[model samples]
Target: MPPISPNELSDEQRPFDEHVRQVMGGLRTPFTSTDESGALIGPFPVMLRFPGLARPLLEWFTTVTSGSVLSPRVREVAILTTGSRYGAAYELYSHSRIAAKIGLPDGVVAGLTAGQRPAGLTPEESVAHDVAAHLYTGAPLPGALYRSAVACFGECGTAELVFLIAQYAAISMVLNAYDVPLPPDAE
Candidate 1:
């Protein structure tokens, strides 16, 4: 889908567009959320096309980013694993940068983006990756793995990890379904 420029937004889309721009602009994100002409990049434009659905999803996204109990590294690991599993290009592209920015080694980021378990993870990070990897297989998470995650992260943190995986998986599906491209700089 071609990007909808800010100037081209309809009345209904304008408010949501402004909300998105304001929220994204306030974040310390590692990736670009807009293009040279200021069109929303990645899934933002697609979301603007359906404000009813986008509003809640954006809320969930904000909550996930702002209110999550998991560490940034753990969250990014789960996201990269899920995004790679779905082959969601934009998802992978964006989170790969985030993963790096948060001090995840290049090799570790590369491995996650390739859907492989990278070595040198802390116990918490390993648990996060395993949880996401197991979920990617479309099977129930094994009892042992779930127990381990709980042990490492506590029940609340583990639950947050699982929810983060589910959220990113949904985001990945959206990016893939809409064929959202990486920013022009990605080329």
Candidate 2:
């Protein structure tokens, strides 16, 4: 159960804040609405309590997750690594599904879930995984690891990777803080 419940507002009672509207709109792509009430599930309902933070965070999350220079395969690898390092179950579960959906190799997802570096990654995927592992372990990236990330991703892509790590970490914090439970039917 989430520590906070979603605001049970109807359309007529929606808050009149433009930022809230923008955040709500941004959520559609990544989340499915509930069947009867059409409410967004996941961190959103918890976030909506503070519309100011919700707007910018959700917008940036959408951009990085959807339009980054990193391939979806590469992005999901870094995300699931963070999820695994933190034992952030929601992140792991959701992104594992996404990883498979986008055709990430099964060995990669399985290795990540077990907190080991999987075999058979492309060179670029390996660099991304290394970076996430270093960050999540509370250690600085070795000079070689940093250089490898820059080489694989370029400077801008590398910067985006850092942002992606931080964003997912924030999400994990929210989910853990709220003790957000997975839906009963989640696999």
- Choose the strongest candidate by TM-score: 1
RMSD (Cα, Å) for all candidates, in order, is 1.3, 3.7
State, as a TM-score between 0 and 1, how close model 1 is to the true structure: 0.95
lDDT of 2 by residue, 1-187 (tens): 3223236654432552334446556644333323235454566556655556666777788677666799888998899988888877767777887788888888889898778889988899889998988998778889999999999999989988989988888888887887766654457
lDDT, each prediction: 0.88, 0.74
- State the displacement of the C-alpha of residue 166, model 1, in Å, after optimal TM-score superposition: 0.8
Model 1 C-alpha lDDT per residue in residues 1-187, reported as the tens digit of each score: 7778888999999999998887877866788888888888898878989999989988887876786678899999999989999999998888888888999999999999999999978888999999999998999999999999999888988888888899888888889899998887662
- Which candidate number would show the highest lDDT if scored against the true structure? 1
Which 10-residue window of candidate 1 scores lowest in summed lDDT? Answer: 60-69
Error (Å) of candidate 2 at residue 180 is 0.8
Would you list the clashing residue pairs of candidate 1?
none
User: Distance from true position, residue 122, model 1, in Å?
Assistant: 1.2
Candidate 2 clash figure, as a count:
0
Superposed model 1: Cα runs more than 4 Å off: none
